[model samples]
Target: MLDFLKPPVLTIQEFFILAGRTIRSIPRRPHYLNDLLMQMDIIGVGSLPIVLLTGFFSGVVMGLQMSRALQTYGAVSQTGPIVAITLVREMGPVLTAVAAAGRNSSGIASELGSMKVTEQIDAMRALGTDPILKLVKPRFLATSFMLPCLTAIADFVGMIGGYIIAIGLLHLTSAEYWNGAYRALEYDDLAQGLIKPFIFGMVVSLVGCFYGLRTTGGTQGVGRATTQAVVVAIVWIFALNALITKIFVSR
Candidate 1:
């Protein structure tokens, strides 16, 4: 009872202590870098197909909707640029992060939870291996590297989708669509979109690893941890996206 009433300050202190321990573990097991690179391939490269497909469809839908809405204003030609701007400045990074949170975060939590349940993490500790360096670091590094790349790919594919729909379905000239897209797609827009994914990646990986590390009570606890990791990662990612967008757009 009294324990439950402990000051919230202790929570912050505990977080810092855990973070320090995690950071300190990084230098002791350098091979985690190699494992991290492999995970990047799995999470980033392998995710490309789905990202591309989704981006393409999203762009097509945007173009179609915008075309219909703007035809009354005789501004149908603006569809391509609008689609490009939206994809590069918002949708690409946001969608990619959501997908990654669902896929990678869940997988990381489940895998690590299973390891914890099986006492494999304990075994590793007994073998003098730091789990944070060997497990958490690799995932953190992989997610950080892969997220930006995925966002970039999604942006590109989404633009292409807009192009196809604009030119083919809307009866707009390909040259006109391309021209508007090229003119409107500013470097700042791309940079703004790209920046958010790195933060999202970090959040996803950290939350997943944190929940997994804290897993207990055998199988049921592991399952709960995995579920919680996914839920928290998704909520944080969306909230962060909104905050970032407010910062950029409000400015």
Candidate 2:
């Protein structure tokens, strides 16, 4: 009767166990800096184009939408500030993380899942090399470091997109738009913007690795793991965003 619940319960338990071990392993020796750098290139550099496009179009769309809404109140001039705040506080981090979850999470799962199914992971274990140390650590560190950088880039590019709409369509001055956008950000806003992506990065990488490491059933299981990694990472990203936002708002 409760068979359906067993998989989920077991998954949750194993996820925490993996997370705990990853965290503990951070301080231990046998650092794989080379692997970390390679992952940074893959996770950070490879994600640039998608992140750029997502940020730009999001800002453009936000400006268009907010313009109409604000025009009703004769506050169309405030579009820059509104766009800046919205992107920095919510859209930039969330969207970037989602893009990353979609791209990198699935990739991680597929790669690791393939390794597991083909017995590469088993081979590593037999050779006394910890798969978690070589694989998970690099990805986890890379994502955590790169996500905030990506969010910042996204935020800036988004502001530029909003600027185009503001100046070109709304007829606002450059000074007004830039000033409003710049002044709207406080330390708290900046903190939240960076913090959210960092946390989301950790979750994304870990979720991908978790599903990857547990993969079974050969090639079919690899596909399944890839799909699940993306879906689960996204769901957790949104959930964590809400919780973190609530905490920030309460303060």
Candidate 3:
């Protein structure tokens, strides 16, 4: 029982320690620019299609749903602002993180887990190289930046989707919808949207790397880590969102 209880606390501590070390190594000598770029290509460019599709569909649904709700008060033109706010403030970043967690997070865990099982990670250690720097740092940097980029793409695409539904389907004037969207979206709101995904990106990569490094029990452990990484990262995303939202709202 103590062993089981210990992992919950121990793992968190280990993860943060690993993060702190990796972050500190960044400005030191022997920076992995090439590796970081490669990871970015994989994490950012590779994720574009999924993010675009997610944004489009989410916006369409939001516009449609909000249209119905707003129509009750003859406020259909407000759909644009509503959809924009929802996607920009909450849904876009959160959903992008969710998609990334499902795709990149699991992939990171599985890739690291396989490397661990194959003893390749051990080989790197024998060569006097830090695996966290060589491996985790690249992924960490990639996810931290790319996730926000992906979220931005998704937010733009989602707004287009909202436009289609609001202007095309609801017969609302394009100028009215877009103007309302522009009016409702303040600098603070947009800034928050931009910031959330970056934070979530780090969360996903860190959790993935953390669980991945802890893999044992052969292939089974790898699978376990991959699943746990996704679940834990997602839970943290929502929890963080709540905390961040509270801060935003209270101000």
Candidate 4:
């Protein structure tokens, strides 16, 4: 009985020790830098179109809804500023992070878990290659870099979407819309929104990689890890969003 208990405790300690070793090993591996670049392309570049589409539709919907609401008070002219401010301050980072979690978390978990199940990760260990440094560190770094870029793209596209809706659907002139939007928009809103996605990216990547590395058993374990990764990533994103909002907005 003591032996069994000791194994579990030892395993837990080993996991943390491995994680720390992995972190320290990152700078020594050049392959991880290459992998990190590839991951950035996959996680950031490949996901751009979807993020843009989502941002566009969200902006259109927000404009339509806000326009209707403001019309009742004869403030329809405020639509541009309202849509721009809301998108920059709230919708862009939040939506981009949610979309990224959906796209990347499950994929990361499944890929890493499959590698583990196939013993490829074990092979790397046998070869004296640190799997965590080669795999997880690159992914974490890639996510940290890419998520902010994705959010910036999303913010631009979302603003364009609002522009289209205001000009086409609401009969607002382009100049009028741009003018009001520029007047109300501040660098602070963009900075605030842009900062959140970087943190969200780190959270999503770390959780996904952590769960992936923890997978055991067989194919069923991989499936379970993938599902858990997405669920946990989303939950953490939302919780972090609230915490960040409170920190930034509670002023």
Candidate 5:
């Protein structure tokens, strides 16, 4: 009983420790510029299609629902602004994080888990190289930097998607829809949208790294860690989303 209780506490401690180490190393020498850029490409470019698709569909559906609701009130034009604000403030960042958690988080965990089981990480240690510095930090920084970019893309794409529905299907005028959407957005909403994804990105990357580094039992352990990483990343994203939302919105 005591031992089982320890894993959760230990995991939390180690995860924070790894996060601290990652943060401290950011300004140090031998910066892995190439690796960081490569990870940015992989996490950013590689994840773009999914982010765009998620945003597009979400916006379209939101516009559809809002159109029906607003039409009864003779406010069909407001669909654009409503959809835009919701996407900009919530859906864009949260959905993108979820998708990335499902895709990239698992990929990172599985890759690192495989390395752990194969003793490749051990080889790095033997060579006097810090795996955390080379591997974890790059992924961590890449995800952190790329998520806002991805959220921006998702927000833009979501607005376009909403525009298509609002202008095309709902028969709302393009000018009215766009103007309303533009007017409805507050700088705070944009700020929150950007901030949420950056925070979620760290959650995804660090959780994956922590679980991956702790993998055991060969291939099975890798699979387990990958699954755990995705699940945990998603849970943390939602939990953090709520907390951050309250903090920002309340102020």
Candidate 6:
């Protein structure tokens, strides 16, 4: 029991150390603006298509499923508000973060793990450049900046998907669906939607960087780090989502 606790505790300590150094380096010299932009493009723009696809399908499914339930009370026409609130308050941010965790986390881990195994990180340190500064900082900043944007896009696309089902399948008028959706959202719901993604972005990026930097055993270690990064990032995303939602709901 104690042995198991030791590994986790040690890992947690190291993770926070990496996180601290990354944050501390942010305002320091030798800023990697180009790398930051590249990561933004990679983690942000590259994630757009998948985010759109998932958001749309999630809304479509929600509309279809909820209609069946609403039929019992003859409230099927209320599908827009239901879908909008669900997506904006919960589904959009969670799904978007999970997707980014799968995509960006694995990429970050694999890329950094490879660099670690090949001695590139070591070489950088030898050359007096900080790996945390050059590599981790940009990725962290980019993911934190972009995940919220992706979540917002996903929420909009999901609403559109809900609209399609409302008009096309449910035979509801466009005004009914759009108006219901627009009105259902409040400032609190919007705030919850945005905050979850920002926290998730930090968790995902930092977890990836942590596992990647600690990788060993050459190629096999890289593979292992990549897998761990995805799994851990996803787990943290779900766990954090639950915790955050609980706090918001309590308020």
Task: Indicate which candidate wins on lDDT.
Answer: 2
Candidate 3, backbone clash total: 0
Model 4, 21-75: lDDT tens digits are 6567666755666788899999999888889999888888888898789889988
lDDT of 2 by residue, 25-107 (tens): 89877899999999999999999999999999999999999889988999988898899999999999999999999999999
| TM-scores of the candidates in the order shown | 0.89, 0.98, 0.97, 0.88, 0.97, 0.98
Q: How many residue pairs collide in each prediction?
A: 0, 0, 0, 0, 0, 0
Worst 10 residues of 4 by lDDT: 14-23
Scored by lDDT, model 2 comes in at 0.95
Off by over 4 Å in 4: 1-31
lDDT of 3 at 203: 91
Q: Please give the CA lDDT of all the candidate structures.
A: 0.83, 0.95, 0.91, 0.84, 0.93, 0.94
TM-score comparison, 1 vs 4, better candidate: 1
lDDT of 6 by residue, 1-251 (tens): 47878988999899999989988988998999999999999999999999999999999999889878988999988998999999988999999999999999999999999999999999999999989999999999999999999999999999888888888888999999988888888999999999999999999899989999999999999999999999999999999999999999898
Model 1 agreement with the true structure over 23-88: per-residue lDDT tens digits: 676666457657878888878887788788888888888888898898889998998789989998
Which wins on lDDT, candidate 1 or candidate 2?
A: 2
Worst 10 residues of 1 by lDDT: 7-16
Ranking by lDDT: 2, 6, 5, 3, 4, 1
* Candidates' RMSD to native: 2.7, 0.9, 1.3, 3.9, 1.1, 0.9
